[model samples]
Target: MSATDEQNLIEVSGLVSHYGDRQVLNNISLDVRENEILVIMGASGSGKSTFLRHLLGLKAPSAGTVKLLGRDITTMTRRELFDLRKQIGVAFQGGALFSSLSLIENIELPLHEHTVLDKDTIQIMARMKLEMMNLLDHEHLMPSELSGGMLKRAGLARAVIMDPRLLFFDEPSSGLDPVTSAELDELIKQLRVALNMTIVIITHEMQSALNIADRVTVLHHGDQIFTGAVDELHASSDARILNMIHRRPSRHGVDSDYIDQLTR
Candidate 1:
């Protein structure tokens, strides 16, 4: 094996995915190294979320290989996938906490379900994770009682409760104020060093992507458009890449037919 193969926690090669007749990902390939932060960026409908799902083995691709920790998850049995997920963590966009469960309950649910740790030990471990997220004080609060930032933190606490070697976060900055978003970005960066984790984040926020990404993979209409360091992305001359970075609308001229219809 090459040194790159030895270091990568995730390796995708020529991945093609479809939802019925609609293609969602097209010939995408990327590698995520151990302890690095890889941010996947694309606008809505760009297939980044699909890419993230493929990485997590939540959906099997129509073709190509997705290897996580030296095993191809695309071909893993159900039981094997379950075992593999024990070493992976995912924080969804909405926090996805049960409204009926309190912060501590939500955070410790994984342990209670997956392990044989005693109640007190589970609570301690959960509390430690909450403390790391600066949420220890809100341990007993219900999900509905928390603010947007608080909810994200609570969800993050749960995600890292098991200290998974690979962490996948979806839109950590979504709906957050600038201050909260920046704080979350810092925390994400710290997690890489603190836990020695390989993190893959899915986001459309350019600032957040630039702030936390060790490397970035950008998609456009299901195609892998760019994959490299932030500096390289900045230097890219591609019109689509430039439009994304600058948040400009795509250049499509108004046709005479559309204008005539509008006049009618």
Candidate 2:
């Protein structure tokens, strides 16, 4: 392996997955460098979520391998995988905070579950993360009491509360105004520098991708059509990439036969 490849924090090779007989991911491969923010972009039903699940070891691949933090997850035992997950963190799209829990409690969940730290220590750590996200005051509020942007920030605070080496974010910009989205983008960038983390963000938001990504990977109908620097993505001559970037509708819309089959 080359020096650069050896530096990869996450490496996926020939990844293939299926939902019963229907293939969802076709030979997808990519590498996420340590301390770099890699953005995975695709339209709905493009296997972006499936691919992310594979990275998290939530699903097994039909073929190929996934190596995370220098360990092959495909071969790891359940206990081994669980232990490995302690160094990783995920922020779901919906925030996924418990309705019954306050923001501080929600952020404290990971530290509580994973470590034997005392309550006071956990609270201090959670509050530190909350302060980092600019959510110190709202730590006492419930999930419903926060706005959409605040919810995203709270989710992010929880994700990084453990000071993980790897962090995953799903749709961080979804359901936010342009200014709020931009703020979240800046926060993501700052977190990478401050925490020295390798981040994988799954998003369809063009501006968010361009703003925070050190490298961008685009998926189309389960195939990885493009992966490169943001400028390379913009300067490419590929029609599909251009269409996606430009927000153009597909020339071939929904198939009549598929629609009929679904309806029937």
User: Could you tell me the C-alpha RMSD of candidate 2 in Å?
Assistant: 3.0
Writing each residue's lDDT as its tens digit, candidate 2 over 1-264 gives 668766899999999999999999999999999998999999989999999999999999999999998889999999999999999989999888999999999999988998999999999999899999999999899999998899989999998998999999999998999999999999999999999999999999998999999999999999999999999999989998999899998878668899899999
Worst 10 residues of 1 by lDDT: 247-256
Candidate 1 per-residue lDDT over residues 1-264, each given as its tens digit: 778787999999999999999999999999999998999999889998888889989898999999998889999999999999999999998899999989999999999989999999999999999999999988999988999998888878899898999999999999999999999999999988999999999999999999999999999899999999999999999999999899888766347788899999
Candidate 1 off by > 4 Å: 253-264
User: What TM-score does prediction 1 earn?
Assistant: 0.94
Each candidate: RMSD to true structure? 2.0, 3.0
Q: lDDT of all the models against the reference?
A: 0.92, 0.94
With candidate 2 superimposed using the best TM-score fit, by how many Å does residue 18's alpha carbon deviate from the native? 0.3
